[model samples]
Target: MAGTTDSGTGEYGGTGGVAPDRAGPAAAPPAGTAANPGPRRSSWRYIGPGIVVAATGVGAGDLVATLIAGSTFGYTLLWAAIIGCVVKISLAEAAGRWHLATGTTLFEGWRSLGHWTTVYFAVYVVVWGFVYGATAMSSSALPLVALFPEGPGLKTWAVITGLVGLVFVWFNRYAVFEKVMTVLIGMKFLIVMYVAIRVAPRLGDAVAGLVPVLPDGSLLYTLGLIGGVGGTITMAAYGYWVNAKGWTDSRWMKVMRLDNRVAYITTGFFVVAMLIIGAELLHSSQIALTSGDRGLIDLGTILEDRFGVVTAKLFLVGFFATSFGALIGVWHGVSLMFADFVDRFIRERFGVDTEDMVEMVASGQRERSFMFRAYLLWLTFPPIGLLFLDEPFGLVVVYGVLGAFFMPFLALTLIWLLNSGRTPAQWRNGLLSNVMLTAAGLLFVVLCAKQVKDLIW
Candidate 1:
């Protein structure tokens, strides 16, 4: 979560935003200083990390959820989708703000919260990444298998996709990773926009959807759409992306905010486009599709019937881009988090002196470290076996429970950190920020409880 006020020292690294040299009287900026380049860098060029987050966070599951909502209720829950994006903007901004304002990574801040934070994260990443690996690879492979039926089948393609993501993230740095994600997300934008236009949504109905309304029996679905839009653990990873963007100080606050806004806004466009497709094509017909990424394949068949083979194929391509972007994004982002978690745990628990770990990590060395690649491998290989079965029932249940609570954990923790003395006064949450965070926290708590209830019952 990112908190920024127009209150700070003058910009130092030729950046447009004010850069506070010192976070507070008590805290110093993390080590590793780069040569300040001439006149403030353009915010336009600094937009890559948000694109990475937006692309990663809005994966196949998000699209499927939006599609299901739109098909079931037309545009009645469109406001929910929009609200989901807004809530996410708050979370991502807070995460980014914590890093820029404090000059410390979010993981380090989590450590300060206590060993429980460390333990929760450690257990979460290992379990979450393991399950997510199979899920992501299988999602990415679905559209491919659909498009090229004669090619590899689902499990084989999943393995291949996992290996491909592993290789891509293991070998590349943030610059290369950011560029690749930009290209893929741009592909998503073009395809989804083209489909939305083809559907030709009614202007009045779409506008009316901006108003909050609850259709009969849509409470659970409404909450799901509102809480699920482009959200995942990647929200927690935003600060690492900010740091990876080489904006460690508050001077980059303006750019970070712009980047964060553009991210959710772009995500909004994607979700809106999919919702339009569903309402126009499926709602009137009252068609039912399976849940999960495979449901997208059913939609493609419908597109083929109504539109043409070309349109259906194009949608499949966009689907591939969405899933694959997430696979690689997690391959990179979460692995970075895991590396930080390991480094911090070792330093604190083992009493190992790793004074330069922060500097080394900030300077991009961590991305290339063995621990980082090990987690990347963990995300790739161990979950491959899950692709064969329906997936172990017990493990899926556990994944669901943990995944449900992550957002609430993030929202409440940010509220605690931002309001506390640990954060500088100027960067702390004000009235609006507190309200938004609190609302977000409550929303997720209800949604999370619902998720657990649904699973158990």
Candidate 2:
């Protein structure tokens, strides 16, 4: 298994069953073995993790954000949406690169940084997961309630969605999860593009919206458009997905970069398509949308009036796919991260060597680990109460505070880890990577400040 050594030589070393703290330099993978299979060419066939990440990251909230930006500012913020995708591409790429280059999980890297990271992550994951579970379930339930208004109440549907996500993630492995997510994302892509075309967006205006411009009172929306497109804590989970996909070393770097770019490009199209719908349909008529996921339901109602019943139902189906995809994606991806966190904690306490653990992560056995299933259940059950009752103000406030800080946390930590001696010299950040990451870090810091301010006042 790959790991660092006490020697300062920046190369993979063999563990030889030594404890993690005293492991030797990593040895190259055995010749002709799966790990050392020389230089596999990057190809479209190696694109599973990116699809999963993209689907997970662009949930209903992101779509609504893009839609609102369109309704509020027409095509004026289109450039920001595209830039947001570019920023996420850098963040995700850095994460994947760190995993491949260092042969250690992102959580392991964070632990090396300090105890503060552990405290922050522990609080963030617990509080954030609790609130996000209900939020995700409710978002998924909205379309189902709209589709079958006579059948079940909102809380009932929310419970059903949460339970369904639990069962799905608990039973399936990453390969099966990736396939299902791809199908759902495909459904979402087609339905969203279909609506965009049906609304007859002005092509010239969309083309012009690519230019950087900020209209009056557009500051927050512009920042939101740039910062919010397809970004979430799930971006930090990209490395775990990359590891889960069995790309555990630097040899897969090219393929990983290709996958990352494809992921964000797909996300960009989703954002742009929604913007077109909002611009041509809602903006043209000066129609307003309700905030949050309900705004999507409102859009479906408007689509029914403007197009037909068939089109409206189709959009709701797409909305469900988008929302549910995110639910399960988090259920799987974040659970993997939590599993790693727990595994590391146990190893440190017991002075266990992590060589086998690294192998387990690479071979996808982490999906079946005890800690993984425990976290999966935690993400599912406890939050159901929030669907039916008002969220506790204190818990909601904590969730907001943590959620606000996470993007900047991810961006800045990545910058620190990648630029430090922890990563192999050859695999460290290049100029372009540094510039993009720095820009992303700064942008998210501003957004984080605004989010904290909103939560406070």
For each candidate in the order shown, give its overall lDDT on alpha carbons. Answer: 0.82, 0.84
Off by over 4 Å in 2: 1-32, 35-39, 352-359
Give candidate 1 misplaced runs (Cα > 4 Å): 1-4, 9-42, 353-359
Which lDDT tens digits does candidate 1 get at residues 272-301?
999988898889899988999888999999
How many backbone clashes can be found in candidate 2? Answer: 7
Candidate 1 RMSD to the real structure: 3.5
The C-alpha TM-scores of every prediction are 0.93, 0.93
RMSD over all Cα atoms, model 2 = 4.1
